[model samples]
Target: MSTQPRTAVVIGGGITGLATAALLAREGLEVTVLEKQPETGGRAGSWETGGFRFDTGPSWYLMPEVFDHFFRLLGTSAAEQLQLVKLDPGYRVLFEGQTGPVDIAATREENIALFDSLEPGAGQRLEEYLESSEEVYAMAKKRFLYSTFASFLPLLRPDVLRRGPRLARLLLEPLSSFVAKRFTDPRIRQILGYPAVFLGSSPFTTPSMYHLMSRLDLADGVLYPMGGFHRIVSVIGDLAQAEGARVITGAEVTSIRTEVSGRKTRATGVQYRSPDGTLESLDADLVVSAADLHHTETELLPLELQTYPEKYWQRRVPGPGGLLLHLGVQGTLPQLQHHTLLFTEDWKANFEKIFGKDTSVPDPASLYVCRPSATDPDAAPEGHENLFVLVPVPSDPSLGAGGIDGAGDPRIEKMADAVIAQISSWAGIPDLAERIIIRRTVGPQDFVTDLNSWRGTLLGPAHILKQSAFFRGSNASRKVDGLLYAGGSTLPGIGLPMCLISAELILKRLRGDTGTEALPEPAPWSATADSRPESAGRAAGGDAKPLPAEPSSGDGA
Candidate 1:
């Protein structure tokens, strides 16, 4: 091993890779990031068309502390680089057969009241539920979220021992059962349970440890970058370069170079094809892949260097692949809010269609609609609207390409029309189709081809109990020395916040440090006059049903 500064090459230029490159450079390592795309943002990349701008992936902004911590490490903050706006009534939920929509308020009190309106005394119960959730979140951040299985010290910590019993219960119980046991109203159960979908599993299968996402929402609140969520990507990229890290876009890594002596094999660097059609090799002491985990294992490394083979990947439960539509309408949509979740009444069957044996596009699929123009007028042309609609489906390339011979199953056009019709009918925008000036559809095929994602999954692997934390793929490789992994597929799991934490964990592994990094906390947020009590009416959308039977599968963004 060299005593001088080491060089590192990071594959994939998404948030995770960029953050890792920046952190490594700050730690005195020469770092280089290679992205196959023309842009460095990966899924966070944006495009302009028809006088509108669209963020390709990851629109929701939760866990503000994670981003703030990452930026602060680069000697800056998200606030300094990108203006952030706190969303009041963070998002709206439109349930099937409901006259009014459920607006999940940003304030703790409002959320409590929102729960109480659904069932008497539910407000107090929510307070208790969140209090427990807060404890779990705090402990998780200190113990599991920031630390890796690189050491057993985490298991011996006083806090971990103290909370062991409770943590066990959380890990053992399914999120669906946990919420159903606490809240009587079906909507309350649905609201609390829906977040588990973001982790890429059915509420019935995912552990209740994920309830921390609710605290991240109700207590911490949701935020958006002033420009768009993609701005965070650019901000992080700039910070990485400012820290002396070099980022090379349009460079597709072909293989991770390795050397073997006797019984030991070690990764030394990577070989990639440049945009100018030349194959180039870069030497490094270490190589980290923040790209799709499956692609890295199956394609980038030699078969002998591969830790998890094709069969291993085949057995893994992947997160949902998305069916997305980006639209530029000639007129404004008055009925839609900045963030809207339109859920169907047959929630069980809907989920079954995604992760269950049936695994197909749901007939009456639940949808998520993001109208960035509702918050930032610059997103669209004057008097026009920009809408990004997403529907979670099974992660399968065959389904992505509309099945075999392109005629086997739900055709992309048919699916898009169904989604549009659902949105038009639900939002009361009857002429939605006619007003569309620019329309783009992204299916499973897009994910598989564009990002080389496993099964065209929008998110990474599903966070089933078996695929979480210590059980999840390690950030550091087990079979190869000097090779590591990051991103949604790796430990500390999915989403942008998780990606930032993934970077931190990777740092800990590389440095062999057991102590957690002390990043500054997020700025205090509170409800303002606009978030006054009863803003959405005492029972703006108060209605309930009994908890439905647990479904075999579920999916969400």
Candidate 2:
């Protein structure tokens, strides 16, 4: 055995890649991260023009504890890395036919009252609903979310065995049906069910297991980092470098180098296109691709060594791709909150258009609008407001990308025009379209071109019954011994917080930690660092203890 630190190569410099690099470096592994873009952040890309800054992806910060846990393992805290401001009215929602928009108040009591107002005697029902959601959230964090599901035998453990039937029921029920069971009001049902979209799923198809999402914003509160999600990228980048990880941007990983011995295959390293456009290969003890799982498994590795082949993806349903509109409005808008959701009257039809058999863009699009400038002045100029809008569309890449001003694919521009006018009439911002000074649009096609998203799905595989929790893709390669994966596409499912959990899972897999021991605290020493963040990132918290056997998934990976 050699005494040298093990070398690891991480592909993609997105949140997952940066986080995995930082943690692995702190664990004393010599890690190198490769990114194709000029900067990190992958799909959570950023843009700056005319003094306006926009986070091109992932606007909502729903799960605070996940952020807290991720940072704590790395010897920092979310409070210390980024200035977190809790939004008072977490968000405002405009229902098409309703006279007044409703705010998801900062406090649960207020939210309960708001729900009660919409539907008689619904306040107590909201309480019961959130309680159940919180319970499921707790169960998932402890068992499912952080698990690799390395084996299905864990399902036989006493605790899990007892909860198996409950868990199954939760997974089997659609989130929309689950919400409808508790709330009679359409507004209330929509409010509880919309979190499914954050997972790149429709409320109608996503499992009720995801209802925990409502607990985060409704009870725990929504948070915004001062500089948008880009700050998260910055924090991870700095930490990775600080912890001695070599991060290279403008380096596109083209293939995974593998070795076959007898019946086993193991990844040796990766070949990439460097900044100078030279083809280069780097050898390593192990490889982790934080890029899209489909692209990583199908395109990067040989057919024989693949954990997930292209044909395998044919059976999986994908989450919705989106038309992202980043607008720099010239004047302040008093009507909009820091976060707002404009839902069309025909809610079912709107979702049916996006996720139904037709798979078409909705005419009167139900969209999400984030005005970070309401909370952060620096997001816009003195009298201006910056808007980050998301319109769920089909995952087909042929819809095409968008350009500056009104210069975009005719179809995209047409939809953009319709949504802008829809918000004007619905949200009561009459001058909304005219006031735009700077504009950029990112479509499903952009997701493919920029992030290598498969089928142009923005959030990867949808969290439907057969595609969520342990049923999602595994984190390790089946055919390749030393290859691993980390990102929204893999198990535990989508969202920024899930990306952080995916990183921790990578560290756990590398350590061969099958037991449910929580990650250790910082050792208050300089042995493993040339800088700060001197702790091994691990499970959130709790004393070392044995966990139930875990359920496993197969994706080749």
| Residue-level lDDT tens digits of model 2 in 16-101 | 99899888887877788888877778777678878888888888887887888888777777887889999998999999889999
Q: Whose TM-score is greatest here?
A: 2
What digit string (tens of lDDT, one per residue) describes model 1 on residues 110-180?
Answer: 99999899899999999998998898888888778877777776468777888789899999999989998
- Model 2 residue pairs with clashes: 154-549, 154-550, 307-556, 519-539
Q: Give the TM-score of candidate 1.
A: 0.90
What pairs collide in candidate 1? none
User: How many pairs of residues collide in each model?
Assistant: 0, 4
**TM-score for each of the candidates:** 0.90, 0.93
lDDT of 2 at 104: 93
Give all candidates' CA lDDT scores.
Answer: 0.79, 0.82
